[model samples]
Target: MSNEVRDELLTVYAAMILHSDGAEITSERISKLTAATGAKVEAYWASLFAKLCKNQDLNEILSSCGGGGGGAAPAAAAAAGDAGAGDAGAAPAAAKVEEEEEEEGMDFDLFG
Candidate 1:
């Protein structure tokens, strides 16, 4: 991404982080920011959203895409504590058991 896009993405992400109390970013907010800067930031918003979907909750991502808000944002505080990779939030023993079950029941043709 270009520097301009990166900067814009960070700005929105920062704002999302700042007001992460599940409050929505209203149209008024978008209009005011546009007026002050004359910058249409929606493209950058789209890129930021695409990146967010890779790891964040799908429901939250879809809701944000539908509009500015009307959905819940993840807890910023929870993100602060490291989850130790894909296994971060999982219970060690439970995850191991699931992994074994997955190996026995793997379905490769699901994509084919």
Candidate 2:
């Protein structure tokens, strides 16, 4: 991906993580998160992303981008079934798998 696009995606991912954790999405937070991913981004881009996401509802934006709750049910059901079979850790593992799938889906939606 181009640097611009990559930076934008990193910024968005950082914002999502922050939002999910109920943390404030600030430029400093974006920079830290992007750095945590080991991705180098321009300061201006990071600032721009922070500004853009500050007032936006990320959940709504993601849903508009085809990330609404339509792909998680089966994975959750399977996990629940596994849990019933006595594997207490199955739910977290299943959730990780589902998250990976969702990330892949988001990548396709964003890049295509």
Candidate 3:
């Protein structure tokens, strides 16, 4: 793929490819992939990208394109259910927690 380079983004794309291919994304590997695609990736940029991604959980990050909190609802519900089974007084606490969670989402409303 001898295409024109798109600067820093090329390095990021190459890193993603390496990650999906189950290859270690070192600066050398990023440089090689960018070069293979005819992109002249700077060595410093490659190293910086490698460093930035060193501790990232790429699999976790890619698992949900829609982002997080899906599991949180189910977990919170289960906790409420479990607590409700034992104590009647615990129900209000659970409801309060849910209300707090909802209020947090309303902090930045789309239609202000």
TM-scores for all candidates?
0.23, 0.53, 0.50
Q: Could you tally the backbone clashes for each prediction? A: 1, 0, 0
| Model 1 Cα lDDT, one tens digit per residue, 23-70 | 444434433444455545554554444454444554565466756563
Selected candidate, larger lDDT, 2 vs 3: 2
Error of 3 at 109 (Å): 29
Over the stretch 85-106, how does candidate 2's per-residue lDDT look in tens digits? 7876766787799899988876
- Tell me the TM-score of model 1: 0.23
Model 3 clash pairs are: none
For model 2, the stretches where C-alpha displacement exceeds 4 angstroms are 67-112
Q: What is the C-alpha lDDT of each candidate?
A: 0.53, 0.83, 0.82
Best by lDDT: 2
Model 3 per-residue lDDT tens digits across residues 51-103: 98898998887775675548698888788789798788888886799899999
How well does candidate 1 score on lDDT at residue 77?
A: 32
> Worst ten-residue run, lDDT, model 2?
103-112
